[model samples]
Target chain A: MAHPQPPESDPQSPSAPTAPAKSPRVGLFVTCLVDMFRPSIGFATLKLLEDAGCTVVVPAAQTCCGQPAFNSGDNKDTRAIATQVIEAFEGLDYVVAPSGSCAGMIREHYPELFADDPAMAQRAQHVAKRTYELTSFLVDVLGVTKVDAAMAGTVTYHDSCSGLRELEVKVQPRRLLAGVSGLSLTELPGAEVCCGFGGTFCVKYPEISDKMVTNKAEEIVATGADTLLAGDLGCLLNMAGKLKRLGAETKVRHVAEVLAGMTDTPAIGDPAASLPNKER
Target chain B: MQSTSRNFKDNAHKALNDATLQRALLNVKSGFQENRARTVAGLPEFERLRDAGRDIKNHVLANLDFYLERFEENVTANGGHVHWCRTPAEAREKILEICKRREAKTVTKGKSMVAEEIGLNDYLEENGVEPIETDLGEYIIQLRHEPPSHIIAPAIHVTREQIAVDFRREHSDLDPNRRLEEPRDFTDEARAKLRDKYFAADVGITGANFLIAETGSTVIVTNEGNGDMTQLLGKAHVVIASLEKIVPTLEDASTILRLLARSATGQEMSVYTSFSTGPRRSEDRDGPEEFHVVLLDNGRSAMLGTEFQDMLRCIRCAACMNHCPVYEAVGGHAYGWVYPGPMGSVLTPSLIGVEEAGHLPNASTFCGRCESVCPMRIPLPKMMRHYRQREFEKGLSPQKARAGLSVWSYVATRPKLYRLATRLASGLLGRLGKVKGRLTTLPLAGGWTSVRDMPAPEGKTFHDLYRDRQAAKGGRE
Candidate 1:
């Protein structure tokens, strides 16, 4: 498979209005963790894309991408999950997810997940090529840095592990945030480190998970940002929980919700009341 | 030989307190990681090569005995002796016998991890042989009476300032007033000291990177060319290599070498790639008169057909160690074994027994950086989990941790009970927060609460929230 010219450099970003537009249909793959807990991330994803001049569609048939079961050595459940996901977004113009962990499941892992079946491997490869994380698609494919959506607040971005390592989703979100008027992007130290939210890993090894997220929260607080922004809701929720428990004055917001200017309500928490406590 | 792991806690205490060593380790740690990343990023097909490399290693490991015998035949046909040892005792005996037969007083050696495994240097010294480590990094550790902190860069825990002091004490003949500030100065001083040992030593010892079965060639990759000098000029040459070092063909060796150097020093290839087929070939201009290959099984063959067979595929690129966050925080010496980092976490337990190195596997956050950057693509974090599983199965886990896990397992298996327990736990913890939403103490989770306030759960568990949301959305629409 050829490496896609990143959406930022593609002819699509600047001249997307004049260029012949391909099918605008996008199948939003609401990842299992997000679907079960943070449904607002799904709606924010829809609003962000539709606002960016794309015809967004949520394939309700989508279920978990089967990464959890697959990585845990349960091939039976993984295949069951993969079969459900493949059927959900089969023949779509593009399959997009708000989570890099899930997109990596579809893009990098799905083919390996079905190596025993040649037909499924081919189908997985196709899906892997078209699938993009929301920010990668927004800045790279849609070529829109600013969503014409604006919010006045200091926000620090957490680079999710899968998104940063697997999909290189660091700069695209940063680029889009830089273009947003009145949005101050505060850089968090050791931003590339994992937030200890490895799906089931949080519950499986909660002690270590708590240590990692607590470290991440301390870094987020050090930035003195009012809100913590990240591409993946899994990390945001984990960070948010820690932030809330510490009574940290900072709110946790998804990059999509910020880019879409939908930060008025508490999707995760209230942004205005966020203040760093000395106890932290 | 010696169980350094038994002295781990004391060694770790010393390692933790030695500010000078810590300073040196911090400087060298990220340098290697950065170089490796830059090198791998240059090769577009590096990841594909990694997969292929892993497959090749898997294939070789599955047919190890056949490959070992084939390698032995090839080495013997090319005028080299092949001695196989099933245990460390046999390996030590064979090497000592060879050294005694040569009547060697001094032995110059290249960097060999396997030698360290067998405790060859200490054994040689005890048997009236003075072993001189020719590798600059190895030589530094020898002077300090310390084992290597890193596999490739021995004495990586020592900085240049410490090296200057070591050189001044070890080589008192050198100009005392001479200022040595640059890396080049240290390299040159070590080289000048070791060059005489290379020529005067009766025996030369080095490690084999790969034993080519088809060519009977023992390949060694090094930056300093010290291994070549040790083997080429010495009267008797001994290659102390592990059983897993054999490859079926030179092509396979090249494939592994391509990834090895790139993964290691981030070079497309190391400065020197030497292939020695046999006793320097009779007609060769410069070579050893007698060549011996001491193949040590040392519990490696037991790994065959086991869950750890993939571990044998490790080319010792040190990528896993370089990328590991835990390894960065507590340097390799803290691991309390010959190998360190993610690979060491899995390997030391298997080779040295889990009871000895059980804490090594637990010393991880399961961050998965090691797996991502691994050139051989070893699923290191998952493998660590397998060791953790073994600890639990063998009842080796601490009673407190075991009880904690038992309770967790019970809760994890029952969703309704789990939710009820979590709800009550979070609610109680939430209400106990003092001083504007912070809990300074907790009974059960004091390990967490001691360091940072345990995050209160967001009122409802995901399961509870989902149930309510589904009901509100008209029974899932």
Candidate 2:
């Protein structure tokens, strides 16, 4: 596949500091959760990519990453969705998503799903090799240690299960967050455990899901972090919704919003409650 | 055991509402979980040992026919009898036949899950033979007429407060006002009562942790030493085990032993590790006079070359259940069968037909923690997924769930249709939920809203916004 003529890029924000040059062109796979529930994370991802000196595009043909089907044991559909995604992003130098779950599906499970189809399996393998979660791509591929972004108050980060276990994304986000001025990170107990927002899992087993999220809520509040940030919107929504129902005042937001210095939007599930976070 | 696994949802619901059980579950964190972490960290070779353990089991499973035949020959050479049973009924019949030949009126048990699996206790009692449970946890549960909630910790769901009441009622021979408030007090009374049962029991039955083909020995590892007493004092000793427990050599058993205690209870080693080859020799004193080994296949040999073959490598460590968040919440009874937790999720379907046990495999978040902690490195989540796939393909899953998946799949495979459908659905739900920034109720989403609110979407779809942003750049991909 040949690359399309590259789009001319503009500096995203004048106040932000970035090293400018011709860089790799990336296609952002705005995951199903991000595309539906929260588009702010998608924009935040764009700003981070642009600020990091990469030309990014959004492929319109993409829909779900087929996680809901893959998880439900529908391999035939999983293969179809994966094959479509491979063709959709086949021309890009890198395919990045802000979700570890979606990124993990594409990176880890897609090739296995298409193993019987030799030609399509090779395509899935190629797409998987270049796919990455947002923060991991920035730190790993772009050599980004610090961001020209900052947020106030203490915030605890959650290691979403797929991100931590399959992709090994525990340290990259932390390493980047360490550079954000005025941000103090507290460790969450059982941070590696699932928040029980396993796509269809929360609905299928609500009592079990409630118990898991309640435990997570108590631990998040116990840290007294005042705010919670995670890489995946599915987990953030689950934790944030539970925290709200429990009458806890702890706020929740996607990690990209804080990392891109785009903290003006309201925290998730906070009912238009604005982030008091400002430039440090 | 008969399965109530079909009512898994309701059982989990009740288990969650039981406050006493909830309080007891808190101990799991400070109990097995912490101890296992500490012991594992102390041993740098734990990972290497796990590899060795997995390899030894894999080798035995590949050559299972050879090892079982060799094991039978060796046991016979050591003056023991081996019975090959194909089903649970056959196994129970064999044990009863031996008991009748010995004129056994009472049998002592030492915490065998296989006995529970075969419903051995109730079957024996129905045949006019009394079965006495000597393990403290098993004894507590036996008196309550409850099945073992967990494989290793039989009474994990029962609180000590509940046990105090049970002891006062069951042990009517004891002082009514005795200090039975502590765990040790309960243990002391149980020890006194069971010490009498040991000498009276004509047959003693215990489960095998490993069956060594080379040494003709059946091994059992226990912390309480009840297994030793059960085997030593009875006139006849019977070892009941599944077919997969056999290993080719004693050294292979030793390697797995190094991993078993630590993974199960976080101990450097269990207190009593006994190996019994056969009946007592002519010169030997204080040992059982008759020795018998019952090897029950019961659907296990059929799993030899299947996707579930890895499950046979499990040593019943209980580490998978200890770290599983779902098991941590509802306890083992909710799983509704002999085994529970991640290992049970895979094995239950294989042993007890998938139709009754399909719900067990579906009750997971696929967190991968169980596979991470398994001593044999069994791919538990993958196997559970395999069960789910079988259920789906066989049309055994619910009609609504299958139809929903098909409808969703039909759209998801068609990119243009999927994008348009999502765009319209989000546009409508986003407007309805925008005011409060979350939805308290949703169509077909009662499971989510019954406990917590659903975070609503921002009004516009991401593609609309992204296309506009890229259009302003005079480019579209």
Candidate 3:
């Protein structure tokens, strides 16, 4: 029942201490999805963190955040993976991930995974206290009000379920997106609803998953936005795939890519038929 | 009643394909979800009220034996007979015995999920006693000989056109060309048909929303006044409820009532909140001559100390289902049980064996929306996961899925091996998808590729790329 306390040097406080002599060391958790499907998100996260005056480290020992195992009722393996992640990201000021889904798995569910073991539970809590979703780390912890980023397009943002519900990452992403020049944000209808890419759930119940993502795709296309952005790769992939299957032209990318002004790469699910086009 | 829960996948497939059901399911979002959101926003204390409601249920559950005993004593003292039935069969037989004692030919019922849980109507028909459903939604589904789909809105899956067709087919004595285009028109017709049945019935059965342990009063909240007429007009009144329905006091019942209406139908209060104490008094003008309360255990007692005990706090509001995307997509019937949606996913597996209803728990995205909107703060997804854990432990999960998970875990546990495997897989997939940037087909991923393409990886793992970046920077700083 103990509440996790915020770090001592509260950046948002009016009387907050000035920048410390040493830069805050950040351990970037390159989520498995971002690591495999789109390493650009990982690079974008690195740029965002480094630009915010922090020293960033990519911990190679970390792979998945143990979410796939945790959600599948395989707690034994989840524990093993979580232990590896904890050991890998030890001694960092913050463990930031480009994904709310993976960050939430570490921040929220890790402690719960080790509830029965007090020793490991303490370690999990320590790691959890330092873990944060990327946008939240930028806006909330770093007091980032604006970003030196620009992207041209009317864009809509889908609030991934874990980020919005689990970590309260609704406004932090939007707070940063509002600062991006030349970007008009059209709010997605039912933005807080899940995109149905529930890790393995999409395949387990593909029919149901299709219906949900199909509805999401319709709403995204209805916005007439040229691009779609979300914080988590899982949801972006799901929506992007469905949008492609339906032959819709709305591009998809991780929110970090747009926030870091890193949209030079082709949008997710877009064919590599055309050369990379920089929006700015 | 009869569980097709074992065939949940097939049921969900059928539900997904049924266009009419799909269209009707849309109303759940605009109707219940939006209304509840607006209503809860208007009331600032709704969250605190939820907390209060949860604490009260937790307290009552902790002393469930004491409260239930007190409830029975109060009911007996109020000139009411309390029947303690351990199983659904016992509860059904007890009600049938009371009906036979009165020599009842027909009985009218108000909306009671417990009745549906016990399959009262089918049992009554087999015993030569006709059970007439008086609630509009209940009556419609009953006429079709179909079980209720959504709990609060029993016939929610049925469109107006379907209901009109059903009415014409069943009520052959009525005019075949009656206009039932409007909701009021359907309700008016149903009212007229059910009016006489209320007075003609020898026994009336109603589900108690809350059984006050303090006063022995059985409370029911209904938009329609049929519950009042059914209980008062019959010669004998029987209240069928589960043991968990007992609350410590009337005040506690009122606190839960504040949440039930807003959560269930977005009303500040139900139009009719009736509380019946025992039967008729000696000086009472018009009421049932005899009163009986049947408390069925039906696996609820076993749940008291288990992980699913929070399920007992459910007030049958259906808020969880209203906000659930999975439930929204497939509708209620696909859950293939008496109770459906998120609550049903947890409760069904517990009430029925988990072996029979394993699919119910597994068929969720775990979006956490159900738990977010739940009035009782039930950790529905957590409980569902617990059911999954049980299935895994019991080897009830599919062998293929288990094998796949094992292979995934085996590699995932070894960071070096995981890196190598993901690097190779991403490299192959990225190469295959070089042209389109996505793969339309892949081996062992037919479920995914059947409806949508799989976006290819960026050809290299982040670990590999980051390591190279570090090497270019001349080692770790």
- Please report the candidate that would top DockQ against the real structure: 3
Give the clashing residue pairs of candidate 3, or none: none
Fnat of candidate 2 is: 0.66
Docking class of 3: medium
Model 3 DockQ, alpha carbons vs. true complex: 0.72
Residue-wise lDDT of candidate 2 within B6-125, one digit each (tens)? 999999999999999999888777799999999999999999999999999999999999999999999999899999999999999999999999899999999899998899999999
B422: Cα error in model 2, Å: 2.2
The Cα error of candidate 2 at residue A214, in Å, is: 1.3
**Stretches > 4 Å off in candidate 3:** A1-20, A276-280
**Residue A105 alpha-carbon offset, candidate 1, angstroms:** 9.4
Q: Second chain TM-score per prediction?
A: 0.94, 0.98, 0.99
Candidate 1: the clashing residue pairs are A7-A140, A8-A140, A13-A143, A249-A274, A249-A275
lDDT of each structure? Answer: 0.75, 0.88, 0.90
Best model per lDDT: 3
TM-score of each: 0.77, 0.95, 0.97
Please, what are the lDDT tens digits per residue for candidate 3 over residues B349-427? 9999999999988888889999998989999989999998899888998999999999989998888999999999999
